[model samples]
Target: MKLTLKKGPLYLQVQEILKKRIISGVYPKHSLIPSELELKEEFDVSLITIRRAVEELSKQGYVEKKSGVGTTVLDNHAISKLSKGQRFSEYLIKEGYHLKKEFASLSTINLHEHAADLVEHFGDECYCVERLYTLEEKPYIHFKHYISKEVTLPENTDLLLDSLYEIFFQQGITFNRFKDEFGTEIPDPSIAEILEIEQQPLLQRIRYSFDINEKLIEYSVAYYNTAIHKYVVNFDV
Candidate 1:
């Protein structure tokens, strides 16, 4: 895919971008990657540069190139480890699933006590973003994110399709430590409507995230419809 990010050497950037796509299940395991000519055209680079990037991916154990069969992606079971955290979405990618997420709604509102005194870190108001994730057009997970006032969001919600962590990273707010509380709860009527499920017991997850300096930066909750799929996290040692 073509991205506007220009970082480091062109070959290295293309390699990293392709590597991320492989790990994120875009070019899934055992699938044939685009031709060298295709990638060269996509990145607007030389064929030599494209080959160099693919060579790096092969050396890194992310792909295997055959004589005439082209290049195929390798298993990405260690994606979570590479990403520095064990997340459900990463695990799904590893298990060969394409997950799509979009903003359902976004608003700035006064922080409430339910967020455990988030006002101390974000004063009175915070950005509330409602995100819905679908697998093959079937809605399954609903995420309600409360971001700190310190971080600025995009004026166009369409530009916020990436994960919150990626967005936070762009704003110089990287959260390294996260605490997750897992349980089952009857979702609110509004949340149930978003998930396309009636009010029922759904798997819930609460995340308290901290930045490099151990400062709490975000608080979010996610609801999962287990009837469709289960959440799996794999640990690498």
Candidate 2:
């Protein structure tokens, strides 16, 4: 397939194209992908660009490269095991599960002392969005997201129904990296009620997302109902 290459970085665009092909089984598991020369000629891009794109695919577990051989697609199970750290919501969708997010509340609020420390420089105010995540139409998790007011959110946008990162990208706000801390805790009464559980230990994740400039732009706490879903984290040795 010819890539239009009209948007985003050349390498990222190429990566997406190749990833789609692999996921759709166009290039079946263990099948060799086109060579660098072939891909360069096909995309009309430089060898460096093609190499970078392939490297990204390898890092994401879509393909594996071997010396004296070639790049080959990995099986779906292998791919799932190798994706380093994926967003739970995105991961669920990729696993062919129906996922939905419902907003319990969305509003701007004065940041409490605890929240103020999370986004160190965001002053004393921020936007707080509470949401419930459903997997296959059943409650699976709950999330409370606190975003820096400095990062402008689009008015009238349904923060619950849309991908927050996508919305931020549209407004020229993007995260370069994020940090996550995981722990187990008994859910509060309100949280337990939302997750449709009773006196159960929940997996909790505290995530801090930073912009390209390394500024903390978002802080979120998520509680997972492990009875309904499992959280997996992959590490490369």
What lDDT would each prediction earn against the true structure?
0.77, 0.74
- Which residue pairs collide in model 2, if any? none
* Displacement of the residue 169 alpha carbon in candidate 1, Å: 1.7
Estimate, for each residue in 3-63, the C-alpha lDDT of model 1 and write its tens digit.
4445557787787678667766889889999999999989998898899989877765678
TM-score of each: 0.62, 0.61
Over 1-237, each residue of candidate 2 has an lDDT whose tens digit, in order, gives 455557768887787677657755788889999999999998888889999999977866668899889999874322332235564566778789998876557778776654557545677788887888888888888888898787676565465567676556545663556777899988779889988789777899988887647888778899998787788653346
In model 2, the Cα lDDT at residue 100 comes to 84
Worst ten in a row by lDDT for model 2 = 75-84
Off by over 4 Å in 2: 1-87, 113-116, 157-159, 233-237
* Model 1 local distance difference test score: 0.77
Candidate 2: RMSD over Cα atoms?
6.8
Give residue 8's lDDT in candidate 1 (0 to 100).
Answer: 53
The Cα error of candidate 1 at residue 167, in Å, is: 1.9
